[model samples]
Target chain A: MTLTGEFFAFMSLALVAVIGGVLLLNLTKVIHMVVALVFTFVSIAGIYVLLSAEFVAVVQVMIYSGAITIIMLFGIMLTRHHGEEAEPKGGGLRKLLLFLGVLGFGAAVYLGIYDLNFEAVPNTLHENNTEQIGISLYSQYIIPFELTSVILLVALVGAIVLARKDDEKEGDKE
Target chain B: MSSVPVSAFLALALILFCIGLYGALTKRNTVIVLISIELMLNAVNINLVTFSKYGVNPSITGQVFALFAIAVAAAEAAVGLAILIALYRNRRTVNIDEMNQLKN
Candidate 1:
């Protein structure tokens, strides 16, 4: 197949996947929402394959679709409310405003891209992709990488602190 | 079948992203909102990979960054879900508006 044909095929598949994602996201139920997200991640991985980043594409599937979504599912299970009713009605006006805001944001991004001259940068991807990333992360971006770890640590600690409650009721004894 | 244009892929991604953003902002359910955020992030990854394919000689940076994004997203999911569990235990509700004890 010609290069153009290949590109078209990939793009069409991506479009279908994205539409499915949207459908899943709009559903009110949490389980279906996460399932749709799996489709979205897999499709985006296809985009990575089109870009010739095979390793990244595989990693996307393993990490996102495999790990992250399962975590979310467990969270849903853990937090399942017993005999609770459906969610209350949210404000329609607020939803309309949010929809408008996103539309405006998209238009602004499109306009910005339209006006600006995008000079395509050459040699954007390194041959030894994973090795280069490791070098950059450890050598140049070490501090920020470490900071991210610290942030995750803090988040972990915070989660524990917030979840734990003292069992003793001192006021009742008084 | 022929491959689609880059612009078409981007357009679809943008639409998906916008819908996710709207859902995230408008939905009161915490779980739903989190799903929307995931949608937005995936849209961004699509753009990065698409540009990497057609634009340059070496096209791996986008993919590398995407990998990192996925890792961070995993951590985020774990923490966010833990928080949701904690919140549910306390308030017995997952609606965003109701957990307003910190509101001034």
Candidate 2:
């Protein structure tokens, strides 16, 4: 096997994503975990670029790293007094069980992938990735697209409803 | 030069999924658990995009699916955090372990 720029890029991005994920797991501070998650999201966007999914890459960066991360930070700030103080509960047996479960799942997936023979087809790239995506999204997968929009609208209303202070209603009554 | 094998992408996604799973299971903070769920969603996105690129058809369908997944994930995160905020307001705690009010 020969080394190439693509391989090197993939390796670097994978390292970033994996390390960021590990940090998100290990970090005690909620804010720090969000920052680490941002790193992972950004690197995943980079990987999308390598996959020639430029539109997805941009969306990943704009949505995941930009919008989602900001929303999480805001959630952390508005909800908690000191967002950095929460620590994992100390339970030796529970921790061991979780560790074992996660490990088993990972090992199973790794073995499954290893044993499966997948033909590596040469990736075909389109000149206009965004156009192709838009065409397919609107035409072939139109229903799901519309449903996703509805889901977002519901989420927006739900967030407002769920987070609004209940005392506001009582205050208005007075 | 051989293009980055599809297996590499699979491996990356698998690693990410496991990490997310571990965090979701072990972390006491509700915020971290939400973030872990996002990580897992991202891993799924990676898989979708990878298959789209290297699959027999090599179509844009996978990317479209990934887009929908991203949107849904964002919505889920928003609602999840909102719920967390409301829970914190009533309970004064964000630790999942202590969120046992409904348990009894």
Candidate 3:
């Protein structure tokens, strides 16, 4: 592949994304880790744009980078005073083993895809991309779309119920 | 633009997935574990969108699937945070290792 602008874009985005993930892994402070992940999520959105998925890219920015990260911070804030992720005795050994296992898993998967190629069929997904997704969601995927709304509602109610302070339990504890 | 091979995208996803896996498995903080899981899901979304564009059957279906995945992930985050809050209320700690009430 000749060095083109697209290649450069993909390269830079992927580098930033990888660095973000690495920082998330290595960062000591949980809040700092969350901040690092914003970079990864945003870079992935850029990757989506490179793949001609403008609508999905925008959604990724809104949902993952914006909504979910904020929700996580809220979770952390409510929980309060979580010190550094302290490693237990012999935990360093466990972490090393896990890292090796993950590396092996990644290598195995990479071996399968390192030579992956497909016939380049020029398609018009880039043009009116949002329109295509909307049409598909409404027509072919109408049922699942509606079901997603139902699931979201259920999750909303369930979260409220699960998180509500129980006066009787509080009385018992007191 | 087409010069960037499908494998490059696939490799990126794989690397991210491995990082997520390692983080989820090793991190003791419950919220960070949840965050790592989110990273794993994000990696899968990348793979889905990549295949949507460059796979044998290039269609808009993959993008639709990615959208649904995003919705489900959002719901998951909400519920997970709620559960974390409740767990912290009872246990007063966010360490995954120490919250083993069910281990007995």
Residues B1-104, candidate 3: write the lDDT tens digits. 39799999999999999989998998888899999999999999999999999999999999999999999999999999988888998888998878888889
**Candidate of highest DockQ:** 3
Q: What lDDT tens digits, residue by residue, belong to model 2 across residues B1-104?
A: 24677778999999999999888888777887898899999999999998888765677889988999999999999999988988888788887878888788
TM-score for chain B considered on its own, for each of the candidates:
0.90, 0.95, 0.97
Docking class of 2: medium
- Per-residue lDDT of model 2, residues A1-174, tens digit only: 458888899999999999999898777678888998898999999999988899999999999999989988887787764656454457788889989988888888898785443566655555799988877878898898888889999999999998897657657989
lDDT digits (tens) for residues A16-110 of candidate 3: 99999999999998899999999999999999999999999999999999999999999888777645767666887788788889989998999
Least lDDT summed over 10 consecutive residues: which range in candidate 2 chain B?
A: B1-10
* Model 3, total clashes: 0
Of the two candidates 1 and 2, the one with more favorable TM-score, higher being better, is: 2
DockQ of 3: 0.85
List the DockQ of the predictions in order. Answer: 0.44, 0.70, 0.85
In candidate 2, list every pair of residues with a backbone clash.
Answer: none
* Alpha-carbon shift of residue A117 in model 2 (angstroms): 4.5
RMSD of 1: 4.1
Backbone-clash count (model 2): 0
Clashing pairs in 3: none
Each candidate's clash count: 11, 0, 0
Q: Provide the lDDT at A25 for model 2.
A: 74
User: What local lDDT does model 2 show for residue A66?
Assistant: 96
